[model samples]
Target: MTIKPIIIIPDPLLRQVSKPVERVDSDLTHLIDDMLDTMYDAPGIGLAAVQVAVPRRLLVIDVSKEGEDKQPLVFINPEIIRSSEDRSVYEEGCLSIPDYYAEVERPATVTVKHLDRLGKEQLTEADGLLATCLQHEIDHLNGVLFIDHISRLKREMVIKKFSKAAKSKVTV
Candidate 1:
């Protein structure tokens, strides 16, 4: 498995909605392995295909605590089937956005339906950090970023900061 390069913010491709996976094949499985490798290498709890410049409705997550056994999960064409009205706030971060983090409020519990690596349909009821991570990664599949959940002013500031950083790298 190869660790793919994660595309940082200010990249237009990150805003593009991902396409659904057509079928589960060897190539798709290979990509899943690579995604898992990339996510682990990133030292992040979750990652979306778009973060690696792949416009596919796929995401990998491992919300296990540090030093505990990893419980990697793959979601293809994931959709939130149900969400509780109860709200919860969690400090969220994304690999695409690097070190930036913000407390985002969302449903305390969520039921997501998606295809597994074998293409079998599965429904997962998630809560706590798992729910937050699933929501965050699923948002990526729809071309949404965690920052989009924050205030307008803060979102613009973050965009401007990353835009400036991207420009500096080009000139250097």
Candidate 2:
């Protein structure tokens, strides 16, 4: 397992919609491992495949607080089958977006369907932080970022800031 460098904003790939995984195999599993490792190393609760430069409808999440058993989840070709009308807000951050974070309002509950790590079908209903995390990562599969939920001016400013930061890092 290895932590791959996250693809940051202004990278066009993050905006491109990810293709669904057609088959689960050793390769896909390895990607899952890498994603898990990356997310943990990121010290993040969730990560999307696009953040790692893999344009696949894949994501890894583990929201268990420290000291709890690590609960890793892999979602392959996941789609939200249901979502509650009630909304909740969370201050969300992305590894791809580095330190920037913003409050994003999303469904308070969601039912998602996907294939698990062992190639088994799994469906889960999540609420609260789990619900927000699920929706945030799912947005990545659709080429949308949490920042997109913010105002247009805010989004543009964030993108420009990140783009400039990226350039500075490149030249340094």
Give all candidates' CA lDDT scores.
0.94, 0.92
Q: 1-172, model 2: which lDDT tens digit per residue? A: 8889988889999898999898999999999999999899988999999999999999999999999999998889889999999999999998888899999899899999998888789999999999999999999999999999999999999999988988888853
Worst lDDT run of 10 residues, candidate 2, spans 163-172
Model 1: what TM-score? Answer: 0.98
| Global Cα RMSD, each model | 0.9, 1.3
**Which 10 residues in a row give candidate 1 its minimum summed lDDT?**
163-172
Maximum-TM-score candidate: 1
Question: TM-scores of all models?
Answer: 0.98, 0.96
lDDT of 1 by residue, 61-155 (tens): 99999889989999999999999999999999888998999999999999999999989999999999999999999999888999999999999
